[model samples]
Target: MKHYLRPEGSPPVNGYSHAVAFSGTSVAVSGQVPVDAEGRIVGEGDPEGQLRQVFVNLRTALAAAGAGMADIAKLTVFLTDLADLGAFRKVRDEFIDVERPPACSLVQVVGLVHPAFRVEIEALAVLPVESVQPG
Candidate 1:
């Protein structure tokens, strides 16, 4: 994938690319909340901890689809509070490639599926054509 961190005439970006260009088998992961496999919320009233769990869920979903964090081309992040943006970036850098980050859109929503949830993330990834096999 080609990451345009700052396209011509575009303003600077903090931790995401302005655009990403890629061609392959698309994988769409559903919005992942801060829940464990057993359906228990991982973090209670902690933004950073909740964000970590969300990333874990995202990783699991991506792996199930034969993709990894590096293959992600886009991300849609939802946060209940904008104040947690710092924590979000810190946790996000742990999962994604900081040098070649994916295109991202962040929204500060009034609430999520659960009031206890502080963060949710969905991803769009592309598996290289060569990596895909006929089924």
Candidate 2:
């Protein structure tokens, strides 16, 4: 079963939920962009800056679902340029501290929502039983 998350005072949704709550032992978060805590785009013209922002964004999303980087099972990264991949990997390690990191995949894409944006990361996590809290 799946439940949508829409906290009070949050903006209206067009056709998608900010996240979905599931009944399994783990929770999974969808792709998160470089949008900041206030929902504004970050690192407008820089790939490295944008990559860091993506991590921040993912952390925020994971927290909302009662999960964290340690619980992540996989991360799929889409990039506009292959040359910028090293920077993205460096930034990713900074946020994820587990010795055995989650599975990861990188893909080169022509473009994203905005041309200035060079990266986007989507994550899937397994919510440990200990991490789940009763609402």
Candidate 3:
């Protein structure tokens, strides 16, 4: 279970909540870059493509931890260019539920460890014990 918060007087958040609360096993995922399982770089210069791949990578990591995007309570996005914020959000809506969007922070970075990468995102997800049942 999760609860989202939006302060009474704070300015409206366009795509995210002010805070989120959850109880259960929490999983912290590493910042995901646009790379395939083979470690091959993807979407080298396209922010939209890169952002999409980043989400794909995030989903894979979450699945490994017995969670999914719907279980995420918070997210931190790192971008080399803020100009891509619109595109980033567009692709995000395709994966995350806008009605119960998680608390998020997007930061502009000078660079990532990889020159071809333009976006990276890390997420925190809370999973109920039942969700961890063995397959």
In model 1, the runs with Cα more than 4 Å from the true position are none
Q: Give the count of colliding residue pairs in each prediction.
A: 0, 1, 0
Residue-level lDDT of model 3, residues 64-130, one tens digit each, is 9889999999999999999999989999999999989999999999999998888999999999877
Q: lDDT of each prediction vs. the true structure?
A: 0.95, 0.73, 0.89
Q: Which candidate is the best by lDDT?
A: 1
The global Cα lDDT (0 to 1) of model 3 is 0.89
Clash count (model 2, backbone only): 1
Q: Which of the predicted structures, 1 or 3, would earn the higher TM-score when compared with the native?
A: 1
* Clash pairs (backbone) in predicted model 3: none
12-131, model 1: which lDDT tens digit per residue? 899999999999999999999999999999989999899999999999999988899999999999999999999999999999999999999999999998989999999999999999
Candidate order (TM-score): 1, 3, 2
Q: Could you tell me how far off, in angstroms, the CA of residue 133 lies in candidate 2 after the best superposition?
A: 2.6
RMSD of each: 0.7, 12.3, 1.7
lDDT of 2 at 81: 90
